[model samples]
Target chain A: NAGVTQTPKFRILKIGQSMTLQCTQDMNHNYMYWYRQDPGMGLKLIYYSVGAGITDKGEVPNGYNVSRSTTEDFPLRLELAAPSQTSVYFCASSTGQGYNEQFFGPGTRLTVL
Target chain B: AQSVAQPEDQVNVAEGNPLTVKCTYSVSGNPYLFWYVQYPNRGLQFLLKYITGDNLVKGSYGFEAEFNKSQTSFHLKKPSALVSDSALYFCAVYYGQNFVFGPGTRLSVLP
Candidate 1:
């Protein structure tokens, strides 16, 4: 059913470069989240949306931006990438509010040089 | 602020032996806890969660976690470890608006 689909599984960017990590869910979930995983650190929330046109900042939202223009898409943007932004990014979606089991995508590994 | 902690950085166990990965959390209101496993070069996968019911929650791949309210802990356990069980384990707590994740613990099962 392609629960969650993320494009450009891997990427490399020079400092100041910009890119977008695309995410879409077929589950028709209402909540979508963007997270980054660094070595020795668990996932850190970057941004999230409860529904189309409703987005919010998460634990670590600096250096990134997100837009939820449609129910099926939530894309994360790296306006000006930095070395510290290099990490594995993940996209997730859940059916209900707080505490719902979230379904995750395979992941996008980004390297900033 | 809501937070999650995994006291151990790494856990080692022999195949066929029992294994435990410790986790603890703190939140203002009722906490919703979760466990996730990550394989090398992959995304985190949901293992189990504690919403409102049973203290013991069983999840995929024969993994289970016991939720202790008094201790504010949700420890993941498996009886008979397999080499395939080796991976990174994360504990998370959902506050009203966000979910906070632990630093993660690496579990290695040697044959």
Candidate 2:
């Protein structure tokens, strides 16, 4: 399996600019997640999807939105980019919750100027 | 709410020496803990997890973690450290369908 894959390995956006970070997993996982990693900080959950067409906000979901149209794809949308949103974004997928292991993507490094 | 904690911001160890990275968790019920490693400029990778069963759980790259129910801690350890073992380690706890990660601890294995 290809595990999880993310697009646009790196991106630079201006203030108020909008963009979408695409993520796909071939493992046929039922749960998908979006997280951000800042310097000197641990990964923070932004949004997650339990299954297709079912999404929920996570701990740090204020500046982001997500949609899971298919079991394999979960995309995160940034309506208005800000400097605070500049961080490395990771997409992960898991078969289920609790003890299930999460497979992570390579991550997209975003820089908002 | 469930949460994890890594007290140290950084840990230093010499090559071939035993290394330990501390992690403590707070949960109301059965604690599901996990350890992940992040290399420089890369994404986080799963190292190991503790759902239940044995207190000692072995994982990738000769790493293992001990779950101490008494202390609510799950500490990652390696018998012999290597230069390549240097990276960032994170401890996490799953609760309410979400996993909360602690502030990462940076490990530097000196050669």
Candidate 3:
């Protein structure tokens, strides 16, 4: 099984451009999360989905959007990208219940100029 | 609110020497703690975790963590450090229906 996968390993976006960071998991986990990692700042939660069609904002969701149409996919959308949004984006999935360890994707490195 | 703290920004140890990476948490109730390791240019990899039952938890790469309830700490330790073990380590706590991660501590095992 692939576990968790992310598309477009690297990308460059102009300011105000729009794009989507695709994430897919073969584990069929019910909890999926999107996090952005910045130098020295650690990882910040962007958005999350408990299950298909159920999404919620996390600590840092201002410049992003997410939709979980299926249990295996949780895509993060970046509309009107800004230079400050340039960071390594990681997608993770975990089984529901309690305090389960997460499986993370390789991550998408985006540069907004 | 749930918070995680890794007091040291970086830790250096010589190969074959015992090493310790400290972590502490602050929460109202029980804390479900986890440790993740990140190599350069890669995603975070699970190292070990403390859910319940045993206070000492063993994980991958010859790593283990001890959870001290009275001290409110869960410190990661290894008997003998390896140069390949150099990486970034993160501490996290499950709280308030979500997880809160620490700033991270970089471990450098010198040869």
| Candidate 2 Cα errors over 4 Å, as ranges | none
List per-model TM-scores for chain B. Answer: 0.98, 0.98, 0.98
How does chain B of model 3 score on TM-score? 0.98
| Whole-model alpha-carbon lDDT for candidate 2 | 0.93
Colliding residue pairs in candidate 1:
none
lDDT score of residue B111 within candidate 2: 89
B46-98, model 1: which lDDT tens digit per residue?
99999988899999999999999889999999999999999999999988788
CAPRI tier of model 3: medium
Candidate 2 docking: what grade? medium
lDDT by residue (A38-79, candidate 2, tens digit) is: 876788999999999999998999989899989999999999
DockQ (Cα-based) for each candidate: 0.81, 0.78, 0.72
In order of appearance, the predictions have TM-scores of: 0.97, 0.97, 0.97
- Per-residue lDDT, model 2, residue B69, is 92
Ranking by DockQ: 1, 2, 3
Q: Highest DockQ, which number? A: 1
The TM-score measured for candidate 2 stands at 0.97
lDDT tens digits, residues B1-111, model 3? 778899999999999999999999998788899999999888899999998999999999999999999999999999999999999999988876777889899999999
